[model samples]
Target chain A: MRIERELMRGAGPVAVLKLLERHEMYGYELIDALSKRSEGVLALGQSTLYPMLYNMEAKGLIESTERAAPSGRERRYYRLTRTGHAQLAQQTEQWVAISRAMLALGILPGPTTTQEALA
Target chain B: MTTTAPQHESPPAPQRLWSDILTTPVGDLLRGRIGARCRPRPRDLIATCGLPAELASLVWEVVRRTRLWSTEKVAVSRELIAHFEDGLAVGTSAAELGVSFGDPAQAAALIRRAKRRNRPLIWKAAKLAENAVAAVLSLALLLYTIQVVRLYSHAPNITRNYVSEWNQDALTVPPAERAWPVYLAAMQATNGYWEHNWHGDELSPGSSSWPDITEFINSNGRALELYRQAAAMPKIGLVLGREPDVDYMVNNAGQPIKNAGAAPDPNPEFISVLLPPLTTFRSVSGMLKVDVYLAAQAGDAQRTQHNLDAVFGIVAHAREVRLMLADLVALTIAGDACRTIGALLRANPQLFDDHQLAQIAHRLAGLGGPEGLRTRFASERATVEDFLQRYFTDDGHGDGLGRPELLARLAVFTSGDPAPTRWTPTIGLNTVLMPAISPFMAGKREMLAKCLDFFGRYEAEAATPLWQRSPTTVDDEFIQFRTSLRNEVRYAPLMILMPSLGRAGLMYEYFAQQRDATTAALALALYHRQHGSWPQSLNELVPQLLPQVPPDRYDGQPLKYCLVDGHPLLYSIGVNRKDDGGRLPSPPPDGTKTPLAELNRQARRWQPAPTAQRGAGAAMEKPLPDGDWLLWPPVE
Candidate 1:
């Protein structure tokens, strides 16, 4: 199922920042990782994904550089800035609070709040 | 796990001038509705994948619509195309790949919206500036319409009738009619900046401007021609253009008009008042020097006599105009002219006949009196008083400041708006706004009156002999009054106050000295003619020649005079008002001081040892102090 636009917009930069924190990822690889990690829930289209990355880069949350991957094809790898790490930490706490509020309202289940479920 | 470190990094952006901010590419992009779409590039469509033609075209269209920088465009394009290729590698059909990316148009719109939000800081600033300028211009236009209605709606009959009465009085006299036009025309033609570079090196080895002096003679010819005409006129008055500025359009040419308050439309960004008169004075002075040189060369005695008469007439015109306008700088120009003519006569003493020399002495005696300067000072006060009475009430509330016309005109002037631009109407709107907020309107009439009073008091004080006048006391009061008005906008209406107002007294002082010195020099010339020898003292010429000796205005003492090797030397006590025992300083190497300093007491003032002065090409020594007011005769 496709994610709603407003929900995707709020979580987009935070998700990108979280992925870049572990290791630099090209655009296509990030799309795949986000799909697999979120169980296809946050699978952004190719068009949506590139523009999102651009917005994050412009905000200084992530920076991009082109390099030859191990597959001998050129790919743009994005890495998190110091600002991105701080932003991720802040957004994660807000999202946790939001999930707790939704759970108290019985809108979301308690199982989804766990780290493994989140991953 | 590719390392983040990458090689071949692009160079950092170069520094741009602040002026380049508006002209940059991003400045253009952000100033639109959704910003212009980026141009479609062929490279985006030329991907290696053997994808379906229609799918490739759709993807290309989407990327082209996004207004990203070239590098950003390439990254977006390649990644999207790579996603498609990955789908195909997973055996996904063309339709499935298209569905995965969503509708092409929707994707393009999302990217565009994102681009707008992520603009560079400079681009954002430029957009803000553009919007601000647009808002200001719109508000200015609205205010401008209100101002125009305010100015034209009210028929200020009191001011109009007052101006008409003054105009009628102006119609009765032809003030300096003959000389005024010629002087203006000559001024327009020959006048230029008196900067040092304009004249070049006066003592250059083979300078051509000296001998022919064609430019000098031609300009003088115009002034002299005008002078002769004015001298021949039956009568001449001191009145010129007057107040409200409309009289110039209504009155006949050559008629004198009463000067009134500031006009609604003054000559916008006009040349300074000091420039026209000072430049004209310099032109006339330069002519006097050149005429004397030419007369000396041709041995044209008649021409020299005409030149002397022309100098007197032109200088008289200058004095009258300057006094009428209360222009202090013109007084200095008058002094400069007198000195130049004096030097000319002293250098070519033989050029004048005995009778002509006596007449010169007589003329000098007549012009030396300070009656004209005093009269002009009083006249300026009366004019300002009239303006205050007619335009303002007893409590200082009247139309001159309260009117929209003056306010608008002043705004135009202060805004530095080009006089002919669309902003002219808007500039006037400032007057409407100013009265509401500006502290100047409270007692603006009194402030103007005070400004005029300062000029009047200082000018009258200037006439007092240097010994009796306390310059520091006068200056202290002036400084105190000015400091009280500091940063106050009300006094801005007194914009007619020239920079030369305070310093004009010095010019008057110099004029007095020049007059006294010229009189003494002429008297000496006459005595020499009668006795065939220099007088023993100025007293020798007292009863028969001079009536009485002229005293230096500096210290109210008899002007210092001496006969050095049979050449007459004369000077005042100068600004310092000290007698340096008739001493003169030596000439500077650059020849700024005329070589005339080498003659008279200057010879002994410096390098007292006469024997040490003798050498093989010793070169001109630096000049000594000439007791400040040195105008000794050249060896000639």
Candidate 2:
């Protein structure tokens, strides 16, 4: 199931920063990872992903450089800057708190066992 | 349930007119030239990808719609092509890829906005400044257009004819009482020989030009007789009509009539309506002076008295005009008469009998009295009021904005140049600027108040005695006020209209002293003729030779009297207010100068020390001379 457009707009930049925080990624890699990791709920088309990347780059949240891939194709890769790393950390905290509140309100499923909690 | 992602769709065919135009051969050539100039080495990765023609065209359409800076457009093009290539690398069909890409127009707009945000700060600031300048220029143009419309839509309503009102009093005087016709006749009877031949000091019997003087008097007997008859007339009654311009009549005509037949101007501009010229009256005074000197030289006391009376009559006639300039001319004529009388008494002591001397003394004593010494500017105030009405729009409450066209005309008029017969660059420039300047200028009511305030101060200052008046008075105040940059803009019209009256005020005082001193000298001449010797003091002549001793105008003290080399000397303490004990200024170290007027100017302390010199410990470059103003025996 896809999230609503308004929810996606709020979630988009933070998700891109989190992905770029781990390592540098290209546009197709980011889109594929977001789709699989979120069970297709965060799936974005080329049009949406490219514009989001450009906006992040403009805001100094991420930087891009064109380089040769292992397959010998020239691809523009994006990486999180220091500012993006901080932003990702902040957004992660906000999401964890929101999930806790949802769980408390019985809107989200609580952990079923001790193992689940530990995980 | 699963939802399909949005597809990147091209614009409908009917909305693709711009795209169609760009595909034309000429458009293609222009595009090629622009592309070479803007993106000299653009990368085309789509061509290498071997993508289908449809997919390739989609990438180009998306990039073209961005409409960003050339460099930014090229960057967007490269990135989009790279993204598509990566999609195709994953074994995705061209159709599936195209379906998921979304609207090209929306993407182009987003990319363009984002790219602009990333531009260098200098470029952003420059763009902002460019936009701001365009906005301000548009606003200014709009405002200027509105102002021009406002200026042109309204017209000045000149309800009053000031010229007719000014001529009303003169017109009421009966023709029989009018002296102008007789004066004109006197002017016509003269041969113009006296005007051409007479120079300064020529009226003196001892002057080298005495021959010319005798001939002038001998030849113009009828003119002299007419002058005497005109002097006896009850009133000047010179009606200044509309036509035959005053200057033309006075300066050009052989016999300028008192009233030209032209009707009064129905619509007259006050400043443009010339005041009746006093040049003819001034000439009459000059001719009468020559007559006085010659008659006195011939020892004919009766003819001398007649000429003196005519000269005084001309002075009285000039005063009736009520103009400050005319008043000044009248004062000058009176001063000349006084000087001629003093010279006559000194040159020919036996020429006049006791009764004749008493008559001359009385006339000199009553020349201006206390009232004439004060400069009158009532007519000047009226002229300014009239000008304000004609030049400004009437809002029915005595307040209105200046009409730009009339203000421009005034500027041209005051420049002392005749109005341009055709459009010139200067007039064109004035036309353009007048509207812009009109908003900043003072309105009619405010200008009138300022004018009244200035005239009021001037009249007050004129009323004060010279000895009691402050050095930094109306003249200095006006100079400082008018010359300031801000005031010059606010009072632009006033700066053009107001004549300088400070020097004229000083002249009035100077001539008043001359008249008084001449009166005293005439009395002294009478005292000597009776007693066979000069009086020991000016007080000795009181109630017999003089009703009372004339006070010094510079310092309210009685006129200084002393015997110099067995002759009676009379003088006043000059502007420095110091008594040099009836001593004249020493002759120039170089030699004697011929012109007595120049000598008198050099001898008299006409002005006090400058303000800068009056400050504590300020050393003057050359100190002003401390000299007594020698009034008699006429400063020979």
Candidate 3:
């Protein structure tokens, strides 16, 4: 099921910045990586993804440069700045605590409990 | 719970106005649109990503579907097409790849929102500044319009107010006898006879006018007696007539009394009434000249000194009434009398007492102040203000354009009919546009005040160096101010009426220099009379003969004094302000041909027909070189 827009709003930039933290990525590459890494739970549309990336770039959380890709086609590559790295670390910690709280309330399965529940 | 993406149902899309106003891309902004070559051109787009015909058509379709500004559309199309090409390489169908990126309509809305957030702070600030400037300009224009309207509404009262405040009734004729023709004829005859003989330097009975003025005085002793009584009268006390037209004046035969020359002109009709009082002063002065001449002929110094005192008394009265032009005439008459006194002393040396010499020095010092000329210019400003205010408010009634009562008092003379002098508001021009044009008068008024201020300063520091004096520098500043003021708006019409306003200032410089020379020369003569020899320097005349050495108004130094061949020689530094070691500069070429009074009359001729500049050297507001204006005690 697709997540509600409000639920994804707060998490989008941190997820994008975290992905860019791994390596520089273009628009389509970032979209594919986000969907695979989150197992489709955080999959975003191309229309939403590009605008969010532009907003981050405008805010200077990320920066973009145009260069030739492996396919010998020009593509805009976005990368995280130092500020983005710090933001991503803080967002990761907040999400982890949230997950732990959800586990205690039995809303989310804990890491060890998740494999047993599936069996 | 149904979780299979809600088993999608097809829905119609929303449409919005595709305004391209906000879509300036970052690249176009950076390169400043003029340098937009750095942005991806359409050819760059096609060459970078080789697409099939259908794919190329789809890319153009997507761009056309969006509401982006031209440059932003090109950038978006090129990037998205390349993304599609990448998808095609991954084995996705073209149509499926296009759908995979999402709806074009949704992308347009999101991009527009993103661009809004990305606007620069500086652009917003610049927009705010532009609005502020527009508001200020509008407010200034509004205030200027209000001021012009107020000036027009209140103009009629300024003259009445100034007249009442200054008590100008003392300078006019009485109303009960205003229409008497005999009085008008006598005034016309007075002006005609005065103009007839005014050019001559020597006012003896045989010279200037042998039979006309001298015979008229001998035959019409009653007229001369009337003038003598009027001169001794404490106040001017003539009531100004506020008649409607120039035809208000008539001769004893009930015919119109035209002006003094060939034709019976009525142009100076307003000043005609004012001239009678001046005529009284002239008569008194003419009689004084006669008394001095006859006294000197008999070698009678006491009678000459008595007549000279009476001339000085009339001069003081003229100055007191603020009749500048009249006062100047009185001073000239006094100068002639003083010359007669010097002649008497020289013809028979030791002819006068020391007390008589001291009294002569004291009277000359009284006439030396620059106040009379200053008051004259002040009255001119008031009159001009009255004239313009009257001209502007001429609302075309019985008393409006056709008949202005102000012309009954303030006379204007030119060769032609004075009908064109009436300035009316034209339909599309002056009526609507005069509000924008009238504020320039404020600048004109300010410059006039500066001219008056220069007179005050020249009087106060009449002994300062030429380099330190303010006339030339103030004149330079006035030219600059006037040029810039003229460029702001065309005020050619009002300028027609008062073209001499700019050069009226130079009159003060002339009068000041003349008065200073007379005072210094009188003091020098007094010194010679007391010491039995000429004083070596002006300092020897101080404390008793003169309170202080009189200053040369031109160079602002003590009047140059030297004894050449045992005679006292006194002179101003002239306009050049250099001491030629008491040597007078050669006079102007025209000086010998035309008498000083005739040249002055030519200068006073109503200046350039109101259609041209008043004088050729009108722009030269600096002092004119007219020799050292020597005071050599009329050679022994």
Candidate 4:
């Protein structure tokens, strides 16, 4: 639910970019990573993931290869091109600046009293 | 996630649109607490017993009480059968119900459902139709489906939901409908006539002169008779032929009239064509019944356009498939005829040396050459003929007629004077127009190639500064590029032939208009008279009013309807997706050209039919032979 709320707040596009920053991966692995890293909290669906992947790929922010694996399963893997890395760097800088401003105003909530809860 | 994408899906279930039905008042009655079998007071019965088929639907209407129940008649009958078998009747108590006819338990009723084999009739038929393991069985099944059951375009919206709901039922429609026997009888008569007529005229290939006319009257006449019989067959294999058959037959002789003493035999050899005399119609019928049960089970589980399309396409193709067979028969006959003539020459004394036949042999080898349809064998045919003529004269066996004169004379004997009757079918060897057959056994491959070539050429012509075929200035509202005599000629006589589908199309056009008050009113009258009250559905009046119920072309679903006190309303949501009953639809939906059934009384008095009127109802059903394809009445 929180992930869905975050998605509504435009975190989805940014989260996808961040995932691309980490490594090139297929929709399934990307879904798996989102679920694992968020401890299963990032409730992304294949439908949403595919359309976003397609949009990003079309926009040239990331590159992908639709090929069969040695395992014989066909998967489309995404790779973080230099353009994706550059976009990620720029996005990260803005996030850092916003966090600092929020902290200076004492508007930031205290860190949640819990473990990362990674899957 | 693994996508469970099976290659084939089950047939569509438009009748099980429970939600859509529930929207109708009749839905409440059928699904209400009164039970699947409901008792209605005698005051509700309006006995119009003349039309029994319509009356049957009316009985359901009074029982269901709603004018629109999505259930097929077969479904209702199955429910009735189950109710009666369980010793249950429609009424609650003696006071609440009266046996005006007879006790429901003891009532003589025909069960519309397939006889519960409760066993797999054929375990093989029960398998998914994706693989080729059942190719032969499936081909025959496809042929059978073509004969009786017709597939129509359906509303895709309720297909999935409808199938799911209907699948829950205990009984489903069998392979053939209840009236199938009568329909089949009609078709069988036509088919028998053709076979009997063929036997009557005893003619064989290469017999003699009058033998050809005898063959023509026997073989060709039988073929015509066979075509005529097609119309009487069931809706399953209704063939929609293209226009232009007479012109094709009148001029271009389909058979090889002038062979170089060698031509292929006419009949095609199907290795698995043999069947036992013990193979009774009932046996085939039983297998089909099982197939339908299996198909129904599939309908319950899944619904997809591809599934229904396959059924309909297979049905359509079954009748139309004869054209493909025609091509096959033509090829084999031509080839065999050529071969036979060539062999005859080789037996004779030295006639232009053996190379004449040898050269023709090279051309025949190209039957497997890159193309798929082999037509046009001119030069090889010519060379062989010239050699034979020279030999006959050199040996003093010439029929007093000289070589050129003889060749010309021979042409007259076969085709007639001046205009040659013996023109060659374009074999792949001589003409670039016809493609080689072996490599591409499928016929459409060459036609597709020709289409692609023409597309590019036409595009170039279109790009020209001015029209070349003729002049048509932008200011002048005029047409250009008339059809050339040769250009207009079609190769196959059967391919171009279409009967007078004229009035049927007119009726169809009128039906497409929702505002035909006469049609709507007539439909309502028929409904009221039959059900003792207004009927709830178009189906309630099928056999009585329309010969058959027409499916909506838009989504291939049954046309939508609602019921009133004494009338059932039929209408299609026009192309605009707005209900137009049967009037002019706006910017029509892409391919949704529905001949929307209106209330039978609403038809306009003088609206001219656009094409041929093919309106829904008992207007007229083309009669058929015993078990043949459905054909239209022959065109003038």
Best model number under TM-score: 2
Order of candidates by TM-score, top first?
A: 2, 3, 1, 4
User: In model 1, what are the clashing residue pairs, if there are any?
Assistant: B242-B258, B242-B259, B243-B260, B408-B428, B585-B624, B586-B623, B586-B624
TM-score of 2: 0.84
- Say which docking band candidate 3 falls in: acceptable
Per-candidate Cα lDDT values, in order, are 0.56, 0.74, 0.54, 0.33
The digit string of per-residue lDDT tens for model 4 on B1-636 reads 232221212222234376445545565566562443353322122222222332333234333332223233333333322222221232223221122222222221211111111114463356435356578778756654542221111111111221122122212433342222332332232222222223211222232433433333333333333322332243332111211222222233343222213332222111111111111111222222222223333442122112222222222222222222322333332222232222222222122223332333233332223532322222222222332333112312222111222234333434534454446322222222221211122112232233334333433333331212123221121111113333222212111211122222222222223212223334444455455775566677566554445443233355556653433445443322323443332222366553322211222222212211232322473211111100001000
User: Which tens-of-lDDT digit does each residue in B465-558 have in candidate 2?
Assistant: 6777776778888999888998888888788888767666767777878887888888888888788999999999998878888888777888
Error of 1 at B487 (Å): 5.5
Supply the TM-score for candidate 3: 0.49
Better of 2 and 3 by TM-score: 2
lDDT of 3 by residue, B1-636 (tens): 121211122211222123223224554566467546555644346434567544555555555555555576666666677677776777867666555666666776786566545557886588679888889888977876785665445333222444443345453546433222222334434423443344435465457454455555455445434444444444444332322122223223234533323332222222233434454456557766665666556767786676676676666556554544555565555556556555555555555577776676666656635543332544544444444444444332312221133222222334244343454323344445545545553333443344455444433433333325443444344345447656324333333333333344445445444555555666666766667778788888777666787677554578788777877776655554456666544445655764443433232222112211222355754224434445545422
lDDT of 4 at B41: 23
The candidate 4 chain B region of ten consecutive residues with least summed lDDT is B627-636
TM-score of chain A of 3: 0.86
Off by over 4 Å in 4: A1-119, B1-449, B452-559, B564-569, B573-579, B582-636
TM-score of chain A of 2: 0.88
Error of 2 at B194 (Å): 4.7
The C-alpha interface RMSD of every prediction is: 2.2, 1.2, 1.4, 25.3
Where does model 3 exceed 4 Å of error? A1-11, A21-48, A55-119, B1-69, B78-160, B168-184, B190-234, B238-317, B323-333, B340-632
